[model samples]
Target: MNQKQLVVRHRLRELMVAHDIPSVQELSRRTGIYYATLLNFYHNKFNTFNNRTIATLCEFFDCRIDELIYLDKKELCGA
Candidate 1:
């Protein structure tokens, strides 16, 4: 079976800039998410994350999933 490469483009940094959020630490506090987890998401270092986490982010930011994460197929395929 062939597996499709899926890349998650984290838009947290962009949102932070637009919203004037000081740091990931502040986001963590406001969202009740772990600082390290937020850092991982900010850096795109996490291989996998749970839906609950995503839900929390969406709720906190009042944004949809598309605004937070983008699925880049071209980058995944190296096109």
Candidate 2:
């Protein structure tokens, strides 16, 4: 069987460093996204995310969704 996993690249940290964002709180303030949500993204804990959030982040960062998340495929071998 084959399975696919959605892997988040989490480029916000790098973008923050490049843009001197300082902290997630600052990012939240700049993007109007909740600090807790940004914190979860920073920590790679993305159990709950939606199009609105993604759109907001993309608009704030001037980036596309592909820059934020991607999928990875894995194959399982059965005996």
Candidate 3:
């Protein structure tokens, strides 16, 4: 995955942790995402995820796409 993608994934997980969510199960309950699909996101096992998953994440996290996921070129240089 690209740096932006990796950063987004890491940030999302950090947000979840900050909220004291101990498991993906809690996120699934809040976001209505299946455990298996959530695993995909948690592990960054795929290069791309479905639009539905993205939308759900945005809604449940109370964040815009740009907040939860951004295409930050600066991340590439470790800036």
Candidate 4:
């Protein structure tokens, strides 16, 4: 199997919905991920997450690597 190419978008809102995280504001407090940045991330206004940020999200959600990231066709074009 081949590894999928990932887009540089963030999906914090989707994660919140799947995990029942109440609100971005609350999640921000809980994750210490910065309210405005997290909001921008969720809204697709921000692109890309830093290694440390990804690590923080994973650590907070107790999720494995695959659970945190995904690939879409647009991301595969250059790969």
Predicted model with the maximum TM-score: 1
Worst 10 residues of 3 by lDDT: 1-10
- Give lDDT per model, in order: 0.84, 0.79, 0.73, 0.73
Residue lDDT tens for model 1, 1-79:
4446766787898888877889999999888899999988888888887899999988878899999888875333333
Q: What's the candidate order when arranged by decreasing lDDT? A: 1, 2, 3, 4
Q: Candidates 2 and 3: which is better by TM-score? A: 2
Q: Candidate 4 on 1-79: residue-level lDDT in tens?
A: 3446556544566677888999989888998888887777667775656787778888888886567666554523343
Name the regions of candidate 4 deviating beyond 4 angstroms.
Answer: 1-11, 75-79
Per-residue CA lDDT of model 3 for 1-79, tens digit only, reads 3354243343578768767778898899888899888887788676776899888888877778776666533345453
Give me the runs in candidate 3 sitting further than 4 Å from their true place.
1-10, 72-79
Model 3 per-residue lDDT at 62: 75
Kindly report the root-mean-square deviation of model 1 from the true structure over all alpha carbons: 3.6
Model 2 lDDT per residue over 1-79, tens place: 5555545466888778877999999999998889988898889887767778889988877787877665555445551
Regions more than 4 Å wrong, model 2: 1-6, 72-79
> Clash pairs of candidate 1?
none
Quote the lDDT for 58 in model 4: 80
